[model samples]
Target: MNKLINRLVLGSALCGFYAGLSNAAVLEVQGEIRPDPSNPGGAQIINNTPVTGYCTEFPGMCGMLNLRSNTFNISFHSSGSIPVGHVIPFGFPATWRTFTVSHSSIPGETAEIQIRIAGVGTRYRLSQKAQEIVGLPIGMDEFYYHTTLWGASWVEATPPCRPATEWGRGADANGTDFTVFWLTPEDVTTCPKSPRYVIPGMSLQRLDVHYELRAVRPEKLIGGNYQGSYTYSMGSDFDMGSLNASDPSMTFNLNLTVKQDVKVEMSADRVYLAPKSGWMEWITHGRKPEKLLGDLRFFILSSSPFKMDLNCERPGIDTCLISNGSHQVPVDIGVSLPSPWVDDTGQPIARRPLKLGGAGLQNIKPAGLPNHLPSLLHFAVPQDSVKDMQSGSSYRGTVYITFDSDI
Candidate 1:
């Protein structure tokens, strides 16, 4: 905390009400005239009665001067749903005549000033009034308050029958002297879930004061109090900017290898609609999925490019078989599909035709004779190249699946 000085009050004719023999005198102390509640969002402030007890001047050259009148000004919250007000306890000496004096010494200094009310209690009393005025809202923890001063004055001089530098060589004897004081409270930690005090009209909150005393003579001593300000915002959302979104870049690619004689295992990547027993159909109608992966496509290499055939039959002597049609479906380069009619090499009959006991006796084979495989193929399509092929290649193509929809 740094002390800022801009002495501007005009010098008035000194009154000898309780005056000593000094031509000039300087008296100073730090204090704040904080409002009741000291927070805006907690509750409205209706009334506040502050009692300030002055301390005795240090036992230095300026200690001999008698006291005079003092002024007190209270400022209220300025924004939010609650508007602030101002009250001046002017001519306070005439109103509250009990401004007394106590004493305490600076650790290493010979001088000592009287003790006033403790910082916490002074603000606590004001808070009580604020809460009483403002109805306590849910989640609110404190009310708002602020204060200022008027008619502040001081001088520099020697006491009656005493030398100008009576205290010591450092005594004023006409050297520059100045003092400023604030009536504030100690720093108190706020509750975590407590509603913040927003400045009345502004978006700022939690204003703090950092103060220090700068000594041009003797030693540099600095001290001050930090309390909530009613005129400033009391929340953390004061000054902010913008936000951002997450855009992910994903690349999908398919590796197709025409192995000489590869043994590949096939399994369902997704239980899409499950396998149906008889004629069945399905239709999907909804928003396009972000990502979809189909089943694996397995097949063996043929001397010439050709389409694989599909067929199926019930195990045992039931003779139940799929359509007797031999259909051909195109297989892009390097794609593979398993065949059941032939041996492991796709060239030898593993089982004869099943006996249906009817005119369809052309296929009469035992249940699991040698190998009558299932009519399912798994393959991985080159997804990453879809965009590239669509952009760099020209096409005059129409593709179709071997199984057509009955609908």
Candidate 2:
């Protein structure tokens, strides 16, 4: 082993949890990575928001709301249905009416209220935010904004339904919470027009909505909070479905928050470096060593993009140097990361140089590693530099390795 001492520098800028505003509260999600047993790498995005902004706004009518590490589902809002031959007021908006019969009607104050969910392609911004990281890969099959949730229990259907659109197919095929690729935003009614009975005690103006979020691969994203929201315009001239309330539209916002954990552990508590094969080849054969090098093993578990850097103790010394009795020699250092971790060009890190005071390595990202893996730290004194060493000389060095997850 090459004789050397190792030092580790780890850091994290964990963001504070944000509470959702009254009815427009933002959903917050959180997750993390560590050496712990149950959830080592923090590969999944978990819910952190205490409450759903939109769900709280519509207490009893929020059909179902589910928030998990991989699976996301919620009911945003729904609207009342137009009775057959009910007037279709196109250019004008109207308020909901609470027409009541005489209080003489006692026990079963029954009212079968019909409601419908309109087909509206609403776009939303989904993100994983950190101080250094910005923007996320949002797509149909990608982690961020995946296909719209369809074919699930949340989206209950009735009779007299139309064919499903590119995004809401499952709504037409009966109903179940499923997913469909997102497409153009079209304002139309794609759900069954059949009337479903409403509980007798609830307000006639009660509204509802049903939707779900696709699984997000937090392992492939920077560790942080991922918040998302979309507002739907109600009424005959707006989006999603029609709202019978006097208000033109009730803005419903759904937010998704994800928090991720990250960490790095050293396998070799302290480092010791020497010639290859310990000192056997040099001492037994009386041959001088060509170079002095050592490899340090480390376990890395990160759900965020990061960068690496190097520094030396007692700076005014030789820069990247080792000194003994007023003499110092320059040494070299490098890093090698395991699979699923790559550079800017998407290549595995191997012997990447680390200059003492120069810009350190950057753009270190996970290509989707779901587990903690081993990495190597290379410290060496090349042949050119090793030749200057005196016989029976003992040299020691102290260097610091920094793993920054800010990026």
Candidate 3:
């Protein structure tokens, strides 16, 4: 009985060995490229290894024969509605924007990714009904790769050419191409360990590209909606031996539209008065000479040149006319303009006073106002002037503020 059991065990072991040999040369590679969830304008690559392979069935028995290397390539193509950015007039600042493309390959293989910009050179154009109206220059000079954010850094796939006319691609003045290389691991033990590699059991990689647009003289751009397009292609080059190679190359279109924008708003339509009696008391007692009546909050968001003006119908009659039947007394009015509001690192605007009776109209010409400007309104009556007024009299007038833009 012992001899018979040993024979059966031997037979089973031989059958397993033969099966491993038959499948030793078979390797299945799978993976996909997707957008990285944690980062905007970034991509992730995931590589999936086959479950039934010589390396899994007969690890030590197959030796190096079970070790095979495959190359996977992913190409990036810009699809419809890529991204759009606007250039404000007068060197107004704009934010940086990014677009992403991703690719995945078989696990445990070397990978290559190529980025190519194809179409009417690197110059972006303003189009009308598919007709080019104006052209703006664009190239690798205006583009940057986010290496630190992507975890794995990428080296220039090819040397830059002297007097490079276009971006990544070689001598071609109209087209550009660049490549990045990385390796996919066989398993978690061989995967790249980094904070960006959030998935522990999966082998993934990512890349990000950033871009921006600026207008030195926004006056040149039409003050309406304009459309443009960019053509790009991503091609992957790899070898899969007897298996079909993953075709990771594609062509895409990026549409961009620019719109002229300008806006101005006030915090309140009418400045409400604090109690009239309190104001009269303060003015009569001279308690606070520079007492604040209220603040006129002005908000301006413009991409064009503009000017603001303050006018009063009664500039010559610079008094809040209070009347009880036929009695009236004049109240003094004063306004102070703070420094011109600045957006980010813009130049500072000088402060000026708006004396209703002294000036014809207060003109505020800001080189560029991208933020809020608060003007303080103060009212008072000379101690002597209040003494001549009747006990119960009321006065009222109007102040007009106007904002004009040169688009």
The top-ranked prediction according to lDDT is 2
Worst 10 residues of 1 by lDDT: 14-23
lDDT of each: 0.19, 0.39, 0.28
Question: Lowest-lDDT window of 10 residues in candidate 2?
Answer: 12-21
RMSD of each: 37.8, 20.2, 30.6
RMSD of model 2, in Å?
20.2
Model 3 lowest lDDT segment of ten: 1-10
* Shift in Å, residue 47, candidate 3: 46
On a 0 to 1 TM-score scale, where does candidate 1 land against the true structure? 0.12
lDDT of 1 by residue, 112-200 (tens): 11222111100111222223333444333321111110111111111111122222222121211212222222222211111133212
Candidate 3 lDDT over 320-348, as tens digits, reads 43334464444344444344532123434
Tell me each candidate's TM-score. Answer: 0.12, 0.49, 0.29
**Residue-pair clashes per candidate:** 47, 33, 12
Of the two candidates 1 and 2, the one with more favorable lDDT, higher being better, is 2
